[model samples]
Target: MHQARETDIDGAALLAKLNGWARSLGFSQIGVADVDLASAEPGLMAWLERGFHGQMHYMAAHGLKRARPAELVPGTVRVITARMDYLPHTAPAGWQQIEFDRLARPLDATVSLYARGRDYHKVLRARLQKLADRLAEEIGPFGHRAFTDSAPVLEVELASRSGLGWRGKHTLLLSREAGSSFFLGEIYVDVPLPLTESTPAHCGSCRACIDVCPTQAIVGEYRLDARRCISYLTIEHDGPIPLALRASMGNRIYGCDDCQLTCPWNKYAKRAVLPDFDVRSVFDAPTLLALWGWSEADFLRHTEGSAIRRIGFERWQRNLAVALGNALRATGDADIAQALQGRRDSATALVREHIEWALAQRPQAC
Candidate 1:
């Protein structure tokens, strides 16, 4: 609850300057939201009650405070929400089809587009602090904190409330100008800036995102069962991945983008303003076998400074094992089977179990 000196501030003028600063800082859009978020609490409670958060206990640990910003960050009276487009600058036209084509090639490994570059957590958080710094310089020092998917904040709720965009059926913030291919970050400030209006949802009758999910993780409109999501299975969930969902994971070794790939709004998706999101050449078109060949050290060295590194080597190997197993099932390639067999003897118990399951997926073995 750091206090700020009492002073008259021009809210609109400050916002205009803020927008300019945000654009220069690589943010696509900026909006301010009031601290009152009581109306969003029920949905938050219901989502947690259904265990939709999967193993993310932190989502529930904060209780209703996530919906109440002031409580989470004492003295916070306004939230400055930001959107930064992450679509790679080099993505070709019809990129969605390119991603869909990658899924068909089980031999090639796939990492989510947003994660193939520098970790957004690092990129956005630093820039957010910079944004806050500029604000302090504009006025006097003020109470402020920056968050970029690093807290219990209801990010999409605040972003939508601040006129950034609406929550599409896939439960992601969507802008008519930027679609859903962007990263969200927030700056919680004590300054009482003018609140922005919420945008109307524009999902219409489209169900492409729901239909395109390989695991049917989206149970219904705007509802996701994290346990069944490939991104969650590969990155968040630890221990054994549910046996039923392994084959559905395909070659996605990190996060999945099927929903965003199929969304019509993504036709308007914008390219990243900063090169921070450009795809690394190593991950540009890597194969499942190539990634599997990496030791823990290799994984660490190659994925340094990237989001994929956060999953740790065990999960990296575990996820690659599943994709290799699926590849074995699809092509029955002796190389794929041999690769799985090579790792079986040396893998950790968790990875060993997955390797055994993969070996069992061979058509003749079946």
Candidate 2:
């Protein structure tokens, strides 16, 4: 537990300096959030009470500590929230429609746009650490820690409070300038910075994201049932996907972007200026059979240093199996059945069951 004495550093002026340093490190915007998040706790408890978080026990494990930043990081006074756009450099205009078309293909392996390039956790963490280093140089080694998408912190709550964005109906932070296609990182510091002005809620009378959800996972505005979300099914949950939600998954193998894609604000989604988010050539035209053919060794080789690697081989196969099941029904390709059969004997029980489900999806011929 390291502590630092605060100097006569003016809060407003320090925030302006931080904004410049953040931009030089590829951050699009920065906002200072006050530490008190007591108001958000009831909604957090209610979401957990409803069993909407699925297998992620971590959300409940942290409890109220998530909202209490000072408790998590002793002496924390203000949280600096940063947003960075993640749309790949090569992504064309009308990219939302492009993603929808990929889902329609059924045989194409549709990874969420964010996961196609360098792991955002690695990219954002390194950049945030650099921003911290720059601050320490000027501010005489101030107490600080950086976090990005780590389970314990309530990142969206902090971002919303700091004027980074208003929380959308899908429960993701949405920026008027950058949309929701960006990554958020935070620096918890002991500086008493002036808090950024909070944005007004802008979701007036719009349920486009709610309607377009294939699994209807957005049960209501700002409420997400993670159990039924394809993104959660593919990445977060470690067991077999629910039989009921398998068909609704379509071709999404890594994460689902349906909610973001349908939101009208996303028409203004900004492209990543940094090359770290450039889409890998492997993901440019990902197909089910090509990805399914990857041996465990191949999977390790290709996804090295990637966010997809974190899911491990077993969950990866489970997600692909579900996608193959959907593909079999859509195209009825015998090759897909052959592919499923090839993996049947050696597949783990979790994956084997998904393979069995995929095999059943092959229509019985008259």
Candidate 3:
């Protein structure tokens, strides 16, 4: 563990420097939190016990270490949490309505807005490390590790406790000003920085997010049943999507954003100041037929620096096949039928099965 030199670096001044650096890196806000996450352990364990995490075995693999930041990163005394807004600058004025309308168009694929650009893991992780490096330069060497959503860190809990925002009824950290259209990152460091005051919850009786979930994934207030979440079914789960939830998936080929789109607070969500989150051409309002035409090489090249690449080409085709199936049922398009026919002999059984399902939806005339 690297230790900082014993010097007179004002902790308050260091925090101010951090905020300035974070803002320059396109981060909306930065907050510092202590290592005590004892209160979050019960909720974490309960969610795991309920099998709400679905196929994300890694969530439970870390055990209690996720709640104990100091244990995850030895010598860590405080965590610096940062938020980066991802709504594209080019997004239309009535983006929420536009997104909802896209969902209704069963023939058009609806990839999550945040994933339409460069992968956030790369964008946030690099910027966070730079923030830590700047802090080290000011205070002399320091023990630190940067983490985005890559680890088992209780990021929203830490962010809320660190005064970033209050947890909304959906259990996401929400700010009256920024809403929840953002990504979170953290720097676990061995410094006792001044903690920020937590903001009060303001969800009131609103349940817009809860009512809009396609799979009713939000089983109750603040509790998400990952097994039924479209995002989980399409991206995380490697097996066939449960038969019960397939039709409700609509045209969501990558991830589901209905909950966030329905949240009233999102009306205040700001566009990204950085170009890293701008929507890529391939993902912006693409038709199911257009995406289904992509070869594996095309998929890899197009998703080169994007988060969608993590699922690989097979899963990518499998998901698109499901969306294509739904589109075939909705549009009765000959192109969709031809596309499904083209992939019926896919190399992977998973892709082949989804392709077969898609072909079954073809209009008899096609």
Please, what is the TM-score per model?
0.98, 0.98, 0.96
lDDT of each: 0.92, 0.91, 0.88
Q: What is the lDDT of residue 103 in candidate 3?
A: 90
Error (Å) of candidate 2 at residue 204 is: 0.8
The best-first sequence of candidates by TM-score reads 1, 2, 3
Candidate 1 lDDT over residue span 199-267, tens digit each: 899989999999989999999998888889999999899889889999999999999999999999899
* Residue pairs that clash (backbone atoms under 3 angstroms), model 1: none
Best by lDDT: 1
Two-way lDDT contest, 1 vs 2, winner? 1
What lDDT score goes with residue 110 in model 1?
94
Angstrom error at residue 132, model 1: 0.4
| Every candidate's CA RMSD | 1.1, 1.2, 1.7
The TM-score between candidate 2 and the true structure equals: 0.98
Candidate 3 regions with alpha-carbon error over 4 angstroms = 2-8, 362-366
- Residue-wise C-alpha lDDT for candidate 2, range 257-337, written one tens digit per residue: 999999988877898989988888888899999999999999998888789999999999999999999999988899999
